[model samples]
Every structure is written in structure tokens, then in C-alpha cells.
Target: MADFTTFLHFPISRCGIHVHESCYGGLPVADPEETRWFCEPCQYGLIEPPHCEFCPSRFGAFKRADISGRWAHAVCSLYTHGVTWSQEHTTTGVSWENLENSVFGRRVCTACSDKIEARFGVASRCESGMCKEYMHVTCAQKLGLLVDETDESDDVIVAVPRYFFCKKHTNQENLKTFQRRFEQWEKAEGRRITVHRRKKALSGAEDALRIQMRETLEETIREEDRGKSNGSVAGGEKIKQARLLNSSTEFFDRFETKAEDSGLSKKEFRDPFYDIKLTNASHVPIGFSKEYIE
Candidate 1:
């Protein structure tokens, strides 16, 4: 008989695949056939005949599809889910929580329909007030176009904004000037307060982002440096490591000392009381030699 296991942990499976007694406050696992589920989405029954929106696959009980009613390939769905796969490369992991609010309508590249939601390549956007097109960062640079720069100093490759443009829509000359000035401003403001880094030469509406970037860069650099220092070898870390090693050595030495003082070889060190007979309180030993007691 088909069981609830048919849906567990499968993509598009609405139910948890593997469960534990600790999952629900130490609740016991109920029989899958006997347990009654009330949630409309939880019941492992086909609500409607399945038709994949992305491909010509026919859906069944075992085949998982998204619960959102859109059954595209996992790759296609990832693009609509927003936050590019490239982000997982620069950052730690990928999450689908932001998919519902994704600005990208689909996972296909805005320039080319190739899948951009996978971890295989990089992607970017235009930061102009308008235009939400997607393109590869290298693609932008290859055409001598400017991509967004970060206020983040430690972010090896600065990430482009979510809403970026391609070279076709942006002016190269203006963008080049902006990039040059941005670099200059960053070097001058290396690790100082934003107010102290403010440049009179950049006092204009267009340069407003430059001022804001200074503040953001300052904060980001400060935070990263603070975190690094806290986790680095300079912050008493070596002392702590030495202390831990010393403590472990002391512990092992004490164990060895106890073993040596016990006066029993490894083969002779069996539990002596494991099979002893005990009839009453009087059966217990009342006295022992001082050497044996010690």
C-alpha cells in the first residue's frame, strides 16, 4: 500500500520526510495509516490532476511538485524564487524564504534565457533608478560597463545590486567617471567616520550615493574588522588555546597516574565486584588494610 513516506522530504512534498520523537516536544510517532491529519496541505492526496508548468511531465503521488501550484523544474522555480544562485557562491547558503518577494520574474537570464538560478555561474543587476534587468557581472565588465560597487571592504568581489542594467541601457562615460570617483572616495575614507570622509568636491545630488556609501563602507569595515579581531590569534586566543591544551594534558596525566597507582596491569584490571554474592549487610567487608584503602 502507498504510505505517507511517499511524500516525506520530497520537493513539493508538503510533509516532513524523516521525523523524530523530539520533533514535537518529545511526542511519539503515530502510525502513518492511523494518524488523522487535518491541514488541507498536509493530507497526502492529489487535489487535482498534475500537469508540470515547465515541462511535459505528468505528476503523481511519488513525484514532488511545489505546493504553490507552480510545478516548474526545480531550477526554473529557483529563479522566480529571487536571490540568484551566484549569491550562494559569495555567501554561505541558499534560502527560498525570499522567493515569494523575488523581483526577478523568472530564473532565465534577462539577456539570454539560460538558467541563472543555479550555482554554476554569476549574475547581476542594474542599480539605476529604473530597469530591473539581469546579466552576468563578467558580461557587464567584458563590454566595459560599470557594475555596482559595495560599501563593503572585506567582500572580495563586491556584489551588484538587485536591480541592475546592461551596457545597452547605461552610459559608459558617466559610469566610468562614477567608478573612478567612487574608488578615490573609498581610498580617502579607508577606515574613518563617514562625516570625516565627506568630500566637498562630491557635494551634489548625483554624489549623494557616494556620501551614503562612505557611511555604509565605514560601518561594514568596522564590523568586519571587529569580528576578525575578536576571532583572531591576537585577542588572547593563543593563551586560551594553551590553557585548553594544558588542561587536557593535566586530565590525561591524572588518569594515567591513577591507573599506575592502582597496581593492576591492563589485563588484570577487571571489575572485582561484578559477580560478588551479597546475602545481607554483614556480607559487606567491615575493614581493609590502609594500603588497599588508599
Candidate 2:
């Protein structure tokens, strides 16, 4: 469902790997060759993997545009405060604008119990809204924090992991909250199903009644017509037929009037569960293997 038309990509001519727009923006600019765009690993001609300046891990790393020969993870750059990218679409710049006063250097990581020094990755706060806990991105990942990959806009190409929450909030608290919501949803769904069944039963009864009324009216007409064809219908018989026909008409009219007065056709029942979203149930806690959880 993502619109990929607006997502810009830079293809490495040498390796044929296409980099995301945000990743390419932080990478060093290529040489002035018409068909020569190379990624950091290909350009630098390194056999070993490049280390991320922000984290100890070498995975998901890109060369920093501001600092020559320095690398950082795209997720780290996004979550870290004071980190900024170039405004122009074609420019390459990811700078630590004012990192001295940033929380990365000030706050101690809760997971590793160490201050996140400069060039050793940035600190990311717990996303529980009120928790003052901070952790390095790698530490957060190792400690079962929820890092949700989200695409907020089509204008930006890179899908960043925006949502972060500690294990307590993600596993325990959110599980309890979701269980409560699910119970409520089940009750509401039961009520809606009951209402639907009752409505269907009522409609079936109405149809049955209408069919009976129509059959009765048709029988009356047939009997009257047979009497007329036989020429044996008396005045009394004629009067009885007329009364039966009038009664049937009045009954149908009364049924229609009652249905209109009940406003059954004017309103509809709306389910409260239609708009209820259970977002907490969808997110899986990080740092845990699926096999282990199972």
C-alpha cells in the first residue's frame, strides 16, 4: 500500500545495489562520472565490513556525509537528537549539529549501565511517554525493546523504525492493556451479533406474515369468483366477500403504517467496534526469537 513513486533511489553502478534516498543522502557524493555511482563498500574497496561510528555493529551502516571516513546507522541518525540531514533532495549531509548538549552524551544507557560517549552510538529514550529510561540502539534491541519499522510519508523514501519501548512497557504492560481491550471487544462483538440475529428473525417474521396475508386475500378472491361463475352467490355471500376484501386491505394498510411509525427503515445500528483499533496487539517485542517465544 506504500506509494513508491516519490521514493528516490541511488543505484551503485559498480555493485548494482540500490540505496534508499535517506541512506544515499548521508553517503559521500560520487565522482563526476555520468554512469559511476558506487556504494561505500565498493568505493572504498574494503574487504571487511565498515563499522558504524554511532554503534559497535557493522550492519545497516552508511558513510556519514559530514565526517569523512565515518559511518553511522540510518536508524541511529534518525532517533538521535541533534542529528540532521540535508534539506535539498540532491545534497548529501547528515550532521550532528549540536551534539555536546544532546542526551546521547549526558544520559546513561539503562541496559548497559554506561554513558553513551560520542562516536559510540546515540541514546534513545524509552517510548512509554513517562519513563525516563534511556538506552543505546543496540542495547535497546538486545533488551527486548520494540522497534517498529514505519513508513510515515511517501515523500520520504526510507522506512525508519520509529516506535521504541522498553521490555516492561512492550511485553508486560502492553500485554495487560491489550488483553483488557480484547475482552471488551469480544463483549461488544457478541452484543452486535445478537442484535443482528434479532433483526434477521424480525425480518423473517414480517415476511411470513405478509405471505399469509397475501394467500388469505387470494383465497377470498378465488372463492368469490367461483361463486359468481356458478351464479349461486346470494346477497349475503356478496356482502361477506366485500367485507373480507376490505378487511384484508385495511390490515395491509395498518401493517404499512405501523412499520413507518417504528422508523425501522430510517435508522441503522452502528457497531462501536467498527472504529476500535488494537494497535498494541500488532507489535512484536524485539530481541526475542520467534522460535524461543513459541
Predicted structure 1: clash tally: 6
User: Local error of candidate 1 at 121, Å?
Assistant: 9.9
Clashes of 2: 1
Which prediction has the highest lDDT against the true structure? Answer: 2
Query: What is candidate 1's lDDT per residue for 154-203, written digit by digit as tens?
Result: 63534344223566676555656555644554343343223322423323
TM-score of 2: 0.40
Clash pairs, model 1 backbone: 12-65, 79-107, 125-164, 126-163, 126-164, 126-165
Please give the lDDT score at residue 14 for candidate 2: 34
- Among all candidates shown, the one with the greatest TM-score: 2
